[model samples]
Target: MGVVKDWRDKELSISEVIRKYPHISPFVIIKTDVQRRGVNYTEKALAKVDPDIHQVEYRGMFREKGDATPVSLILRDGTSILTAFSVEEGKREPILVDVIDDRIVLVDQGEILEEVEYWEKPDYYDKFTSSGKPMWQIAAARPQRIDINPNQYCQFWETPGHGCKYCSIAATYNSSKENKPKILNVDDIAETVEEALKEPGRYESIFLTGGSILNGKELLDEEVDLYIEILKRIGKNFGGKRFPSQLIGTAFNEEQLRRIYDTTGLTSYTADIEVLDKDLFEWVCPGKSARIGYDEWKRRLYKAVEIFGVGNVTTGLVVGVEMATPKGFQSEDESLEKCLAEAEELAKHGVSTVGCVWNVAPGSVFFNQMSPSLEYYIRFADGLDQIRRKYNLNVDMDNYRRCGNHPDTDLSRI
Candidate 1:
């Protein structure tokens, strides 16, 4: 027999349990949890996806979309919840995205959570550029953002056992064949941006990111130069005035940072630290540790605030990764305490921290590891949100409107 709960059972419904923290939007909670658990599609749900109409993988880093896949879903309030292509074994059963009454909805244990819609296929997706490279590969359009990942594979991964454990960039890059030996064509990117902007208010921000490039006369000089050139070209689309854009790139020193700021129309900057603590940072991010060291990385991020100004510069952390086995913290409470402590340290330097739930990818080194618990994720998100509020930091670049990947920033809407 199935278990039934009375109205008094706080655990019966997420609504009942979350009522105490009314400030945290239900949408944010659902989105965070969905990202943490990922989602599965029913056969009926898969039958609903039409590649011609739905925006599936044309050129993505990981997990190609199938006709039966949910193609990613949005909540009733328009918040995007992505199904992590890499999920762990002992985690809770993923929610089933199903087609009910001709509508897409999240079904968990027989209860429907909310209705969802597929992201509209961008017009430029089908149109190929002069070189014949697909526009989707050149640029990916979100509801209100355009993503430009100029480089796909990180050179650090080339070193044996040095890539970030939670990351599957090299494997995904190999499998997808999205990687090329050459850099992405700047002209192609600029042309695609021009075409995407013709959609009439479909986009508000442009995002640029890629794998870490450690090669240069000075470390990352080539990487910085590449972004500056591309940003200059993209800036041409906005008529040379500074536009709304964020560059999630490798941590560069003040000189390189100044070069990018002075040379381009980039309004905000971010460099993902990936993990918070120094010891775990060395173990998980051996490449970054070997090159820049954790303390210097934090120093560079703080220096960015002086150039970009507070609220315009921030750093990103991959939440729950500090709990990886062998070198990770033992208990959830201890991990949360340590994580929040480091986030608070960054916040004091006027740098805000945005967290993405750890999605244990199959191709990554740490594929067999389990992520933190749902309750732990909720508390960790809440804790980070509280820190951001305390510091009066704003995350416009990585916010709900610009980037939908971070649960901590999504709470900023409140």
Candidate 2:
């Protein structure tokens, strides 16, 4: 195990640790720490934001980086850290991104760690639709992809105890004006995609994801149909050709998967298993287990690869959640072993795996729970990366540039 750097107390700097793990990008390590602890802006940092050019007060459910604040920061290398705006009680001392001496840099106790740059606003961000809806609201642009959320509220949250333990989707949804509109208008989505595509060479892929839609002819028929409609609409922009896209939704059956593929230009599919271990998944994601069952969920993922094709479909796992207390794996070593084994099983069937570090948010059931150590995460990322390589599966859909949230996928670049 590597020595834990006392970066918060300034006892040991992250820069020192970066030298130790030369295999992992220095930017990634910093991004992980910033995300794990969260960030706080100094007055100087906030002052650097430009409302007109940057995305500030656009109508959305979540807060913008800042009016003049850059949407997100990029390190010396092109690693993106798209953090949410959150200020909660007892939070750790977040790294401060400040404009010190006319240069935007990450500072801790006035120690300049690295020069950083804000994520540039996309070309279409300033454009508006003929109907006057700001294109940014219609679709949120990432470095290499466009994000579309069809529904904001997960019905599981409707009941007192059915929601997942580590989710703030409903809380975040309630706060957004765009999501407050409830369901996404299919016409609006089609129109927005049409306009967004006008900026040539801007976007490499389009992705659609949303909260669980439990209503339909079958369990997720309604959810499946909603995507089918939107996909068909967006397909117009691709001239009926399948574009690079992924749908991170609830696990759908073979029938539902086929229907979606036959109807739209979607090329990749993802159904986040969330937690790798079965018992932890049951307790942490009660709604998912009760509705789809753990075995069925994995089955659907493998089945999706059959429909979407291997290298084109994958399942996401919340990397640290397997260690959640009470029913979770007792040891970090055990958790990593189990998660990698399961991932390999899925990979053998042509279903790739991606992992995102669990962010223990205030609204989650595991809010008070602590995540695993950084060393544990690094090992887990390394292990999962090996599994993908062993299976020879492709993860271009959620790789570093496309998604940027998955540490395991991030390691794929190595």
Q: Which one wins on TM-score? A: 1
Model 1 lDDT-worst window of ten:
1-10
In order, candidate lDDTs are 0.80, 0.78
Model 1 regions lying over 4 Å from their true place: 1-22, 58-71, 84-90, 177-182
What RMSD does each model have against the real structure? 4.2, 3.7
- lDDT tens string, model 2, 213-329? 899789999999999889888888779899889999999999999999988889999999988878888898999999998999999988898899999988887777788787889
lDDT of 1 by residue, 124-231 (tens): 888888888889879886668999999877988878988998889888778765446446898899889988989887899999999988889999998999899999
Which residue pairs clash within candidate 2? Answer: 49-68, 49-69, 50-68, 61-176, 165-365, 216-222
Cα-based TM-score, every candidate: 0.91, 0.91
Q: Give model 1's TM-score versus the native structure.
A: 0.91
